[model samples]
Target: MSGRWWLLPGTLCTAEVFEPLLGALAVSPQQCRSVRLDRPAVEDYAAELASVEDEDIVLGFSLGAILAAHHLDRMRALAAVLIAANPFADTPEKSAARLEQLARISVEGPGAVMAAAWPALVGPDARENPAVGNRIVAMAEQTVQDLPAQTELALRRPGAEPMLASARSRALFITGREDPAAPPDRAMRAAAIGRHELVLVDGAGHFLPLEAPRACAEAIRAFLLGRGQDRS
Candidate 1:
């Protein structure tokens, strides 16, 4: 039987952000679907995902990962992948940083906020590639309008460490080696709590799905296939 996969995009992102990765995975036998979160809160997104009836593999990127971590207990997925997300315990510094970014967005507007965040979101190679860079920027521009509300929701999101530690489903954490927003070191620590495997794509940045779609697809494919074999 073919496997089922559900993808969740990051904060302020539509399912469009996963297009490249989804296209890369098209040849796989697994059926892939991307969940578009219209609401901003982690709980809201989690609730939507939890409502899905089918047993599938869930892959969440950034904010989506946070949501997945928050609702893992309620989800009926076979396995979960948290991509470019910080699912560890919250810290005062992290909260402060988010607030600072929120303040910046409030003052400078969404476009400015996106421009400021672009460096951390895309890798140098992506920026150098005209097509990739333009596409990433366009995606950011399209999504920026939702930044303020999304930022607020992110700040209010509950820490996922407790959920991560006790989650019944197998978990995988994937991050870019060069991702400053969710560094590999931090991702590794977060994955360690759940004994989850961590996969770092060498040349990618925060937007691993777009910047390194092939690598991301390969890692996810291997993980899901291996888990499927174990189950059988």
Candidate 2:
């Protein structure tokens, strides 16, 4: 059956980040809940999900996606849409690098993540797009308070493999072809471990929901409508 949506944003992301995707989805605000990542632990930040009801759908981007998959069994939701999902454990190198990033961004201010990872965050072709560049920068600026705690969460995060394998069969995974953070190949391989489905958005990068909101919405619509009687 079709279900209401609960949208969760990624690290350094605010609820406003999903505005474009929400508009594209064409659902009324009353039928959807926009959640934030305030806590520092995966399970802790996910406390906002307590209100989820039967047949509901949890849709999350990046870190939010990983959280939804990892916590699926604990909720009564019918399915999950994990956009830009990378449910694996952080490599030691990734953790160390995140540490360096924390130190750097702490000194450089909130917008520093965009400066440090802009090339990787946006597709090469999109890097020159003034609109995309400006919007993401604004998003980063808006997310100043959540930066440090989210980075620390990324460091303390354990692999979501076990949970994904056990509870995420109903998950639909999507990522951008150009997303270095969740590359298509890696995302496909990761999803396969849990036997979940994945869709790739060509020419887009890590922020597909922002960079290609319509495309993201179309893919999501098809996925949901294709689920027999569930066309939310």
Candidate 3:
């Protein structure tokens, strides 16, 4: 098991989103450190991420995964585990859609946005659970105190392909089979381009860490252990 790790949570998420997965992985809090999206500029985010030691493991989720993919070369050892990653570039159409989302957040409030996003964020099984949906909404609403600023940080993220290609061997991508936002195919595209491993959890959605913690943890363990074996 790795002794230290640097965790990056997704947009509007605190390190709390990682609690379930970390518990599932049997990693102690002392061995882990996490960062939030306080910085507005992408460069600022990268500058802050540089604090991670070369030997420490990285585990990033969603938007956090996208950031990790761009900054892969910074870490010299222990491949990053990027979960529910969306490595695609931002297109004009996509940006426009996001603008609409931002507009909605302004008019209807963050809770309304979270309501619309909940079903798409989880698979059918998780959607059926009131507790799961409620928690996602609550967490998103709580952590996203600065909703507009947090939303803006992810607006113009550059394509991750070029960045990942240089440090292809230092990353692994994991995604949910049913994830509409970052499906298996998208993760596969990244894995293929980056020349890294890809793991797809069955019946999972964008929130794999919470939806299927055991499966997510198993894949992370296998990647870390198997990668170690490869070096041996």
Candidate 4:
């Protein structure tokens, strides 16, 4: 049975964020589908993804990765790719910071959150690239309407260490060298628990798929092929 690719976007992004990476992978629209995860609660959000097939290759980014990890038991996946994922338990400081960001979003609105998070979301090179920076900002704006709920869900989501540690499906965890949200060290630790291969992309920040689509795609492609699950 041939497996399909399921591209999952982060909290402040839509399926469009995966467009460049999908193109780089030379994936046909019919062979791959983007799953929208705009729901507020983790359970509700995970429920929305019940349509995923047993043979689907789940590739999740950030919050989506968290959700994917949460629901790994239900996915009978061919393989899983986690990009800039925070699969470990959240720290007190991290939880507090997320709550503070939520509060700011509630009062100051999404624009303020975006402004504060922009630096950590992309690499220095992306900040210099007007097109990439603007695109990231625009995508954030588009999904900011759901930021409050998304933030709440992300902050409250459970850790995936136990689940990933026992997962039978081959997994790949990719992190950005400069990602403040999920640094390489933290990601490495998490990947160790799952026994997943970890790849750190140079000069990338939190949004590795968007910041380094070609590199991300290549890693994903090689992973899939290595596992003999080539969708191509």
Q: Model 2, which residues run further than 4 Å from truth?
A: 112-116, 227-232
Q: How many collisions between residues are there in candidate 1?
A: 0
Worst 10 residues of 2 by lDDT: 223-232
Clash count per candidate: 0, 0, 0, 0
| Model 1: residues with Cα > 4 Å off, grouped in runs | 1-4, 27-34, 38-40, 227-232
Candidate 2 lDDT tens digits, 1-232: 3567888888877766677887998866777787767667877855567677777888899888877877876777777888888878788887787778767777887676676566668776678777776677777788868877777777777888777777733777878988988778767876776677778878889988878889778877777776422211
The pairs that clash in candidate 3 are: none
User: What's model 1's TM-score?
Assistant: 0.83
Query: Tens-digit lDDT track for model 3 on 90-191?
Result: 667766866777787778876778877888779989998777777777777777665566567678667878878888236778788899877687788888
Off by over 4 Å in 4: 45-48, 227-232
Query: All models: lDDT?
Result: 0.73, 0.76, 0.76, 0.77
Quote the positional error of residue 16 for candidate 1 in Å.
Answer: 1.7
Q: Return the clash pairs for model 4, or none.
A: none
- Candidate 3 lDDT trough over 10 residues, lowest sum: 223-232
Worst 10 residues of 4 by lDDT: 223-232
Q: What is the TM-score of each candidate against the true structure?
A: 0.83, 0.88, 0.90, 0.88
